[model samples]
Target chain A: MTARRTWATARRVLAQLRNDPRTIALILVLPTALMTLLAWILPDSEWQKYAPPLLGIFPMLVMFLVTSVATLRERTSGTLERLLSMPMGKGDFVFGYAIAFGVLAIVQALVVAGVCFALLDLTVRGSAPLVVLIAVVDGLVGTALGLFVSAFAQTEFQAVQFMPVALLPQFLLCGLILPTEELPTVLGWISWLLPLTYAVNAMQHVVVDTQLDTRFWVDAGVITGMAVALLALGAVTLRRQTR
Target chain B: MTTAAISVRDLTIVRGPVTAVDHLSLEVPSGQVIGLLGPSGSGKSSLMRAIVGVQVMESGSIDVLGQPAGSPTLRAQVGYVTQDPSVYSDLSVLANLRYFARILGVTDDSVERVLDQVDLREVADRLVGRLSGGQRSRVSLGTALLGSPQLLVLDEPTVGLDPALRRDLWTLFHQLATAGTTVFVSSHVMEEASRCDRLLLLRDGRLLAEGTQSQLLERTGCQDIERAFLAIVEGGAS
Candidate 1:
């Protein structure tokens, strides 16, 4: 709950990440590479049309995997127990993670969008900053989701298993494969409930509009609320000590 | 005049059908290095966890620093190092200490001071993962020393250490005690009992005896603490 302690936790997480070069590469470089590969694999005609929404999805997916596993490491390593025994609260621990990964998400979004827009020629009618903004927001959502699911997992392998449970549904139903309206009625309703559905919708809104539009605002609000709710859940489930 | 650093009364902890600490009543005096001695699974860990306010108990109470165990006020006052070297192995020793000191709101100079105490100053920038097992443990110990905690709770810190390193750590514990820090150390190694200011001998979640080395030796009429422990266990059973 204390801001100073939360800031300290964020710095500690960043320091830990800095020490591992492989993880750094994974965090800063992998998403852009995968997005480029996506541009290559898909037909040229389809790639740009899909790229904007995919920008949102890419960071969320990558950040989710990385954040969940990293937090799980903190749990297993006994550092979490030590900190909780100190003057640290669950809010400081979880939100501190949010701030650290929030920084990572910004850097990641910029790199991935930078490469796609500059080289792959992904077209956007709206402002480029809006595209980057949505991508960053999606990354935050992914980080929140990662932190929440890590509570259920004891080992790194178990954390990986949680990805499918927490993320795959959002992918399948979030309009990546098909627009939410074209799906079966039950699935369409379900997709409306998924945070990534709003992420995809908001990105699609950006693809056609010139400035911040009303529909984009609505989707942004919903998904942003989703991020806050998920982060709170993460804090609630985070244990001070392993019983 | 002796004041209680820690006081536990009728404490019971049930961990899924096993009574880890059953009706345990004991008091640790201020500024004394009290050893909680027991065989493996004798509830030493459970008792330590209770005293630090991390473990859930079935009934009873523990008071630490005149506050209920686990109170927010005591979080900074009580320093606990688990059996595992819980420090981040991925970070440098200095980074580990700095991060903990920040959480405790202690000055960063304390981080350097702790590095000196744990003898990790030479390898301050070295990643904890690269250190020897004994060195990694020192990092955990260094973390607990931050903020000049009033009470230090260490759980089985010497379980896997070499004899020389173990002796050195014992020296550090006594030094901290002399500075008016109540150090509670747990050990299953009977020989280490002689190093503590007083001892609480536990077996199967209950206290067998509590006294100084000489008192325990004389009371049980044995030559050494090891034999004295066995005799007490046998006599208590009968």
Candidate 2:
């Protein structure tokens, strides 16, 4: 396909995103509401005392879950196939979705940040830009995984079914409700592979200590790697799905 | 006459352990209306998709509009309409047309012309899912017609249309052929298949025959294309 046609496909996906009010609301509202709830409920004293990980990782869960509704719907409704049949590249579609979901993630993070600053009286250890950057990376990882899920899923129900398969394991290993340090060696190794573990570690540093550490960079790297891997798998799966 | 618009040599599609389209070799010339007539599971839809590069073949070669089918450059030159009316249900008729036109690299003027030709101008603002079945077919046809593609591949375009509308759609296909677009339509209706300039008869994942309607009728010593088809299949069975 020509460059012009690729642009047109991106424009079409954007238009559909705009017209689908339910998706628009989910994209814009759900993350912020979840963020507010998590921020007010979890504090440094409570976090350090009981479930420290959940306080930091809750936003990552919300970001990843958001893609399930929008991306999965597009694949199920035949919109993705329709786009593929046209003069659009699979890479373009993936990138377009990444950008859309990334924006929504940022907006959600900001709302949570706002709530964190005001109600929870929290401050980040790292630079504000670094904190947002980590959040965006987590969002991209979520969206990429969602894209892979949509590619293999034959129906909306199948797509939704992936959420539990995707979320429950991450929640367990992410050190969100359970501390990774306290987990067994085998489980700790598994947690290291998950993108959420790194993301929460990075965000937690910023949200709690207001400092940038090696852990932040390490988290970003892991999440970025997961995004790339998921994207490659998503492309191959999408190609096979259409074929 | 123009060169063959689509040339397939040893085209084969395999699903699991079964050969869906087995070594199907055929040449379709430009401006000719060709029918891929077969029963269910005879690979009609699979063949159409293979020709358009939407289906991957296990072993085969396809040249569409003098270019290999899977090449992105060549893929853009042929229009493919699938079995379903896959327009967004929430979008207006005009919105869907414009969206497809843009994706196919056609301008708004071309979109308007195609919609007008399909008689969708009056309901351009209506939602596509609300449109009648026949009207949806026109929209699908209009999408394929945009950019004036050199070849058109439509799989079962008239499946649910009333007899009258089906006939009208055939007329539109003929008109398109006159304008130099090679039209390959898949249909199970024998009468509809007879209207094609040439016919390819397929059964059990193999090519049963390929020739003009009259040639098939004469060769099989049958009264009509439908009888010719039945005779050949029954004879093969026995």
Candidate 3:
């Protein structure tokens, strides 16, 4: 948990990503592209109504895909083992990854939110910074969850498989398609257990409510708490040896 | 007595049903190049991993640099290069070295120093993915060389390297030893055993012999290390 080592680990991850253009596009460009497409295909009124929730969803989805596969690659390539053999602690690696991906998540959220407000003419009742804040928090949740999930996967292919199994259900149950309260009791309870539900609820609150409210703070707190918990779990579960 | 660079006492490691390392005990002195010579599955890599504090052991103890093996204090003191090239393929050789140098808490100049030592200065800017397998291995080795670590545990570093490169690497190993770095390198090639200052012959997760080339040869009544190794293996079997 040395701060200098953790920062070094984070800088190393960023340097690796800097050398890779495709990953850069995936991290920084894909969210903006997807948001623009949503604006273009849907009618103006529909786009305005749907953009807020989708904004929360896009960063989470993209960050999850990127973080899981990247971390899995680190495992398969023996880079993680090499790092572990050095003085770096498992916490350093996990937190380093969280911080690195957290930065990328902020960049991603800003790009997506900027496009939604500036280019698409989408408006929200609350502060624009709040929208960006919720999006960034959603991205952090995705990053933490991805790190936690990568421990269960032995290969990059299996990491990709986890997305549909682990994340798709959360997407379906997070009130994007239908309101949670409108669903069956069991299903609504399940949605309540998911971090994505809190993320979506907070973003929706920021978009529709003019003033900060208790519900908004509670939702944001839950999302942040989930991220921290998952990151701690990831650090605990990380295996240093490939065999 | 001079302090041993590494001391393992009755170390045992099990992977699944197989006992990969069985009650192995040895001492590696400082400022020497020792080779752990064994076949592919003889637990050479596993033993090396244990010495570097990465492998889980069933029993016994390993002390490195006056600390328990794998202690936080030993992190910068030990450098390890795995069988597989562990550098970031996307980054150039210099970039990979720089990253590891930072992790080792060394200045960036250490990167250039290691690159020069491994004779990779000309290709410092080349991406590791684009380098040949041997060159990529040198980059991995270069990463371990940062901070002039007290002990270097390299697992099968020359497995796929050309004879010329292998010779060059052995020369570098001796040079590092001359500069007071203890090197514990693993190799399956019998001919390479003669190049080491001392040898630990392993078979089926146990040590067959531990001594200089002539000592092993004389003890086994064989003319060369290769025949001596075969004789020892045969005698152990019977």
Candidate 4:
């Protein structure tokens, strides 16, 4: 809970991200560039109509990739262990890492939002602050998932083994590619339990809402609650690993 | 004698159904170099891990630096360099030093001074992963010595070093001992075994002997520490 230690951890992580070119590219360039490319290629009829849902998927994809890659790299290189040995507590480390990744997620979210406006000629139906809030919630959830995966992973190869567990289930059940109404009853219930499902729905409410929706706030609350739960789980898992 | 730097009472560590380190009550005094001597799988490394809070003890109390081990203050005061070189391989020697320096909150340029002390300032720009085994060991030593810790715990530090460097490293250890740093080095090296101020001989998760080199030899009527170790292990059978 110490802000000073959290800031130190965040600075160290920022320095590493700056030094790593591939990570920098992934953080600053990929999301917006992909958004622009998709905006340009898709015509006005079919693809442009699905821009909101597709755009919602972009942040989760970015979050999953960045956090998974970053945590795995840190664990494999022993930096995670080194951090654990420092004066910082487990909660602070998780919060600091999540804060930094949240910054990156904000950047990526903005780029996607910017591309939607500039390239696709689409206006956001909701306020920009709501969009930023969604990014923050997504970032926290993603950081927790990444740290949880890193706890069980001994190496980068083993960390990659969590891709199916971390990413694939959300894509399949989170109503990304298909509608939740079309999914099976049990599978649809599982999708509702996913953090990303709540995040995506919240983003959709932000970017495509015709009027104020109470369900969007509920979705945002669900996402935030999931983030808190995942963070607690991550902290316990990390404590076990360090011991 | 002053209070023991390390005081463990009935220390036992069980990894699942297997007891890695059994009921091992012992005291390691301040300003003395104690060697935890044992072969692989003999609970030597497990003892080191339990000392620093990395491994959990099933039932026991470990008092380090006059407080319970794994306390925030005790952990910050003690320096533990694991058996494996835990330095960042991608980071240069200077970068590695700076990272630890920042972590320890040492304000001055202590990294260069530590590297100089270890005679590694010349290769400060080289990546740690690219360095030879002995050089990496020096870096690990530098890290443990960074804060001038009262209790320096090193696990198998000289495993890959050559004879001459190993001798020099032991000399450095003795120098630290004279400077009042309580050095605890775990190793299976018999020759280096003689350099410790005291020895904690362990086998199969139990303490076989704990005393000075001369005391152990006289008690067992053995020629050297190695012979004394064999006699103790063999004598335990009867």
Error of model 1, residue A17, in angstroms:
1.3
Query: What docking class should model 1 receive?
Result: medium
lDDT by residue (B130-194, candidate 4, tens digit) is 89988987887788678778898888988988988988888888888899989999998766678
Candidate 2 TM-score, C-alpha based: 0.86
Candidate 4 lDDT over A65-171, as tens digits, reads 67878777666555566456556577767777777887777776677767676667865678766766676567667766877676556557877888677878887
Q: Regarding lDDT, does 1 or 4 come out ahead?
A: 1
For every candidate in turn, the CA RMSD to the true structure comes to 2.0, 3.5, 2.3, 3.6
All candidates: TM-score: 0.95, 0.86, 0.93, 0.85
The clash tally of candidate 2 reads 8
lDDT of 3 by residue, B51-166 (tens): 88778888999999878887878888998999999889988888788878877789988887887889999998898999999999999999999978989999999889999999
Please write out the lDDT profile of model 1 over residues A27-88, one tens digit for every residue.
Answer: 77888888888899999778877888989998898889888888877767877777778889
Question: Local error of candidate 3 at A18, Å?
Answer: 2.0
Q: Cα miss at A63, model 1 (Å)? A: 1.2
Using TM-score as the measure, name the better of candidate 1 and candidate 3: 1
Q: How close is candidate 1 to the true structure, as a TM-score?
A: 0.95
Best by DockQ: 1
Q: What is the lDDT of residue A21 in candidate 2?
A: 75
Once fitted onto the true fold, the runs of candidate 1 whose alpha carbons sit more than 4 angstroms away are A152-161
CA deviation > 4 Å runs, candidate 2: A1-7, A32-79, A112-133, A152-162, A221-225, A240-243
Task: Look at candidate 3 and give me any clashing residue pairs.
Answer: none
Model 4 chain B poorest ten-residue lDDT run:
B99-108
